[model samples]
Target: MSEYYRILGVPENATAEQIKKAYRMLARKYHPDMNPAQDAAENFIRITEAYEILIGERKPPQTKSAPQWSARDIARERAKAYARMRYAEFRRRSDAFDIPMHSLLWPRWVNYFFIVFALFFITDSILPKNTIKCDFRIKHYKYFDACGKVYHLADPHTTVEGQPTGDIVYLRVTPIVGFASSYYIEGDNQNGFLHIQDSPTEYIAAMYVLLVLSVLVLRNKTKKFENKLLIKFGMCIVFVAYLFVYFIWR
Candidate 1:
């Protein structure tokens, strides 16, 4: 009957496969276990009844106990039910492949990298530049050594004044020179320096926090070992390239 077909959301000429598919899809959506809507149980009963009748598994109920319903009212109800089913199907498909905002730019790991890098630059710009005054002796024409720490003169003849104090001379120290080594120390000397500039400890700590958060999020969200490996590889490349450009290139 037209009413049975409408209840199951299938065409009257639909094949057995189409009828079964439609029934299953609608059943899953309206099933009491899956949907908690106020009328879900009633809709589920109708779906089952329609399915049984269409498949010749059961006969339609007698009209003696059935409530009288006008054709216009039935048509309106069918239209509403079909609209709800269509909306549910669209929502299910959307949820199955939900895309994250960060994924628009790159993978999660790359997004983490860019976010942390951007924060570093932003904080660096906000914080006042700091410098440390230290004693250095001219090691070469452009190179200088302060205590055991060695650095190339940023302005050579212009920044340093007068003569060296014996073999040692006083000069301003700014660690992690150049654009890429923002979080690392620059000079060859590991010790001996005066406080003149901002300490990189906070910036480095922020980066570490970002790294740990990214790792935790990735561990929870991704199950594939290859994906984890790719993320690690990308991080390694970022570090290696940073070091190579700023530390080795100089």
Candidate 2:
């Protein structure tokens, strides 16, 4: 039998209003007087019959025997469906880790942070420093903390009266980033004066390099990778490198 739903172009669960609307639209388009096509009259008759049967105005036509399916045919169809499903899943997983070109180096937030830090670095480096006279003492013969700020000296060996000196010195501090850029010590004779200079430029650059490496190693939306052991090893390497650069190498 002809499917009433297919003839009216409406689903089986279509509401009465929906079926009526579909019948009206199709009838108007396929009416013999409106459409001069030869099949228009036949289509209009079919839609009219479908509308009557669906609205209980007439009895439905008798249906034919149902098509039979063998076990082998069903299994073959299932296997084909399974293969298609697996292929779709494989595509999704394969492209999960594909990083975009813009975010290849760093994420959006990280990029913004780098820009702010660079601006601060440049502004602090250019602006005139606020020099404060404070008593500087050598700690482990490498660095000293003065006025609640740490300073790494370029040359720790300063002679006072022809000996290793530890005395009050000028602490040059920048306003923006509050970095202690350089320092100088007073001398009795004009020729005996010492002005040692050091900056955190190298240390800051090293820190940024390490941060970039870290982002490359760990950045991913899926939080997964094929090389589990290699990823952990790379993270360890980054950690060790950061420590060495910040403490010993900086």
Candidate 3:
């Protein structure tokens, strides 16, 4: 059998375009009409075969001059190529998936930041007792019971007979600018609210105000990451507020 590469008259490294060019040039020269000899017919067949193998509809195999792969070696190389393709596909799927570890863990990291700020607010709000003394009976109550129980009694200050009277009195204890007089009425619910000065008791009124005046800030669209961040921030605020309330009640 004639060497196909030598028939095509090209190196093993020639590309498809080069092979086609070589085949066309040879076909025109060795064509049967141009050469009447028996050997000329044989060369025509070989040239046609070479062109069919190189540039036909089916993709050609590697050049005839190239070394062939053994059965076991060919199988092993194909297996390696399949494995690389599968690995790349797996990586793409993993990147697109909503893996809880990556999605949840990262967004929760924002909570720690807000917690530090809440802690600062708490630490500043919690001040230690003053070293100085207080002058009045309630001043003693304030100094001692400020961090403990707060006593809320009924109608501590009032006015009657066109004069400020006892059981409930607004004592003007300040100079024209500087004294702190404080009292309040029990709310209609009696426990939900109390004031530091006289104010009308309308529990339903206050609830109405609370409902109308408040705004809900819910930016969390149930996105796992964003919800995690919001929950963490909420927990920090709750924890700080609880600590403050605890110290106040103590």
Whole-model lDDT per candidate: 0.55, 0.58, 0.42
lDDT of candidate 1 over 1-250, digit per residue (tens): 7899998888899898999999999988987668999898678767866887789876654454544544444445556555665677689767644544334324666756655764564465356544443455667655555546554544323244622234434443233342222211235332343332222322345445445545554444654545555555555565555444334424
Candidate 1: misplaced stretches above 4 Å? 1-3, 6-37, 48-201, 221-250
Clashing residue pairs in candidate 2 are none
CA deviation > 4 Å runs, candidate 3:
1-71, 89-112, 124-250
The candidates, ranked best first by TM-score, are 2, 1, 3
1-250 per-residue lDDT for model 2 (tens digits): 2388998888889988999999999989987667899987667667776787789876554333323444444345445544554576578776654543224444556544544444555566668878878876666455665665566655534333333355776766667656666666554233332333455544455445544544554454234444433444544454455455445322
Better of 1 and 2 by TM-score: 2
Which of the two candidates, 2 or 3, achieves a greater TM-score against the reference? 2
Please give the TM-score that candidate 2 achieves against the real structure. 0.43
Looking at model 1, residue 166 earns an lDDT score of 45
Best by lDDT: 2
Evaluation by lDDT, superior candidate among 1 and 3: 1
Clashes of each: 9, 0, 6
